[model samples]
Target: MKRQTHQLVLAILADLEVYLKTELDNVVIYDDGRGNEDVFFRITEKEHLPLVASLVKKYNGRLVTLTPNVIDDETHELVYHFDIEGLLINCTITVTDKKIPSITPILKSADWTEREMKDLFGVVPEGHPNPKRLILDESLAEGVFQEYIGLSDAMAGAATNKLWEHINEAKRKRD
Candidate 1:
């Protein structure tokens, strides 16, 4: 019975692919904790996001959230994470020449997710109207998040120097 249900979902996705225009690069399906099937797919740049949303609507699937991740390379690839009805679908799209396609036009919910990706991964959504810093503030030390990741491996002098810089900067600003 479970196998049959999985096959049915695959058929639906395959049908959606024809209209999607781009070939489905990859597909991953798993059972989410909520007893619904979770599906992830890597697809080409054809802008099938709204189609996916429509599928979610037809299936009564909830639109959970969207997250974008950056792949560090000469041409960074943007991975969009979509959670629909407990199923996580990750779509990876390549950006050549630092040009990222805007999904906010398709899904209004993609606004903030694009902003976060911009600040953290340096991937700018081309059509995002209000792209602003979401992670760091004015007072945050440059590369603080990156530095925090390496805090455990930082040498004593390096740590102290960074700390002193912050302290002196604070003092200088106040004085």
Candidate 2:
């Protein structure tokens, strides 16, 4: 049954490749060795995210989660995880300008996750219905986490001060 499900997912991805009129990059299938498999692939273009979401919906898949990771000062990666008929599929897209087309418009479940991503990573989800702060206060700067991650101790010293300033300001507002 697991083999059949994996084959079905591969076929669906193949169809997606055809629909996009190009081949997908970094495609990998990992079997957890415990009767479960995960399909991972790179979307290659930010504009194609909506199309990918639509295709996943067509296959009756539910968006499981969306995660944003900072690759460097200028690059961010968004990973969209989905579950289709009990199979896990992960699609990743690289964003260079800190903006990517939002999937919230297509999948309502993505609304909060997109907002959280915006607040944490400073990656604007273009076209998100409600792009307001979700997990971070407005007083805190967007992408606060991005600034601190992977920083040298010297650089972190500056970031730490800035973070404390924001925290102190937020605290004062409540008093």
Candidate 3:
């Protein structure tokens, strides 16, 4: 049953590729050696992200999460995970100019995660209805996580502890 469902999803994705006139790179079913399989594909063009989101919704798939990984100083990768008929699909889009189209308009559940990618990774989600910071203060610079990568473990821990202290103080004042 799992194999058949996976094949059906692949067929739909192939149809989408043909309809969109775009190629999906690294289209494969990855097995985790633990009786789990996930369908993964990469969208080389960032513009196609929203269109894919719309199609996923039309097919009754729900957005699971959006994860962003910094590739280099000027490049990032955004992976949009979805669950369709109990099969997990991971659609990845590469960002070169630190900007990508927001899928929140198509999937409202993507709102907070998109904002989080913006705040933590500095990847701006253009067209997001509410593009405000989700986890970090506006006063602090964006991509705080990236900035701490070069720091020593102790230094990073200290910085994180200090930031948490500041956050706690603010919460106390608000209360």
In order, the Cα lDDT scores of the candidates are 0.60, 0.83, 0.81
* Local error of candidate 2 at residue 81 (angstroms): 0.9
The C-alpha local distance difference test score for the whole of candidate 3 amounts to 0.81
Poorly placed runs, candidate 1 (over 4 Å): 1-8, 32-35, 46-75, 84-86, 138-149, 152-175
Model 2 TM-score, all chains together: 0.80
Segments of candidate 3 deviating more than 4 angstroms? 1-3, 31-36, 149-175
Please give each candidate's TM-score.
0.61, 0.80, 0.78
- The C-alpha local distance difference test score for the whole of candidate 1 amounts to 0.60
Which pairs in model 2 have colliding backbones?
none
Using lDDT as the measure, name the better of candidate 2 and candidate 3.
Answer: 2
Which ranking of candidates, highest TM-score first? 2, 3, 1
lDDT per residue (tens digit) for residues 61-155 in model 2? 77899988889988988899988888888998888999898888788878888898888889998999998899999876788778754557557
Between which residue pairs do clashes occur in model 3? none
